[model samples]
Target: MEGYGPAEIEKLLPAFRAGEAGEAKPPTPEQDLLGGPATTPENYTLQLSQAQAASPVHQDATHAPPFLIMHGTGDTMVPETQSVALHSQLVHLGRQSTLILIEGFGHGFLNPGNVTELGPGVRLDNGRLEREPHTGFTAQQSPENPFELEGLAADHEMIKQFFNLHLG
Candidate 1:
């Protein structure tokens, strides 16, 4: 989804907070998918409001259902803190939430090739987020790594268990 960058964000925050339409401003930077300074299409405020309207995080999550949020520590596209904050909000509001932060895993870390490289990630099943400080095989292997296969199996089982506990 196309979005505002740091510059546009600075401009939009005031209007959004006041619940007003965005002011007319020329596009600032080259358009990029990573939310970098980009050429914003016409009607910037309209887009911003639309995005906020569609975003779950921006809306009222009071009646939200259970959530299984899995994020990679190495993900550059979106910081791990975003997921953490979401999980925190959900739990604070007496909602069911689970967060798993896989270490050394970048974007699309759930792929078979994306095995733990730095170490074991943390899990927040209870209230507190606990880090699992343990090293494992890296994910940068030419041939399909055995560690990847093993990791995939373990992850699959975890998903199954979560589903069974919640759905069954």
Candidate 2:
């Protein structure tokens, strides 16, 4: 949902009169929808057409289905703020929502070509991350840090737990 088929899609696309923010007036009809004002020209015309039907954020979240949001703070394709906004809205409406932000990951984090440091020279192997020892990365993957590849495993575990909790 951070970058795809969610109600907030219009906000991330370059379309005319595309979408709305929480309780926000849709962009003027002449403006094109954008992730934010920075995503496009300042003079583009836009609006959140059929916003209520397009994005769930426009609807009441008091009765929304359980939600588990996983986003990467380093995502360049879609900012983590979008997840932040949706989660905030759900909380504000007293709905069940959880947001897990993997700090150093990006939108394509799972891609083999988008790899990053796991522990100094260490990296994920066979679905696990190994430290190179005597490296600065050892400190980077500490338990308190949810920004490392290990955090991704924790995130997956949490997702599984979230589903079990909600589904049962």
Candidate 3:
């Protein structure tokens, strides 16, 4: 249960369900400013072809438990299209899933509006990222801030409700 296999995912399920884990750290300005390498159309096509070739299809027809797939709209690292594609596949397979796209959010939920003073030396920005001056967590722009984009918390809540209805 170390990699991206079923066993690993199963082992993490308890913490995930309890909402005690899965919180991703925010990208620093340096990390955010660095753009991806340029890709030509041909290279893109080739990558897509390779991915399609390696992709696996779920063949099981049995009903699956409800799923909540949330993706950040501003996620430059992982395109939102990936979540859309997964949601589409789930729907095609007659599974129950809900996809929530949070606007202004990036790969992580860290946003300026979500910042809150945690303690004397700790601060949490947008519930998506934490800042500890001693630990090198500095003030920076985050995708989790509602002021960065409207309805972020609401969207998150919607996803929460979806999980509650299906999983609970």
What lDDT score belongs to each candidate, Candidate 1 first?
Answer: 0.44, 0.46, 0.39
Tens-digit per-residue lDDT, 46-161, candidate 1:
54655455444555778876666666566544556666666666667777766666665444444443233432343222211122323232222212211222343225455566
Q: Please identify model 2 stretches exceeding 4 Å from their true place.
A: 1-7, 14-47, 50-53, 108-153
Error of 1 at 28 (Å): 14
Per-residue lDDT of 23-124 in model 2, one digit per residue for the tens? Answer: 354433122333333222332333344333456566777777766665555555556766777777777776666566664555544334435544443332
Residue 14 lDDT in candidate 3: 17
Question: What shift in Å separates residue 161 of candidate 2 from its native position after superposition?
Answer: 1.0
Q: How far is candidate 3 from the true structure (C-alpha RMSD, Å)?
A: 16.2
Candidate 3 regions exceeding 4 Å error are 1-63, 110-156
Q: Please tell me which predicted candidate would have the highest lDDT against the true structure.
A: 2
- Once model 3 is optimally superposed onto the true structure by TM-score, how far is the C-alpha of residue 140 displaced, in angstroms? 32
Ranking by lDDT: 2, 1, 3
Model 1 off-target regions past 4 Å? 1-42, 111-154
For model 3, state the Cα shift of residue 114 in Å.
Answer: 12
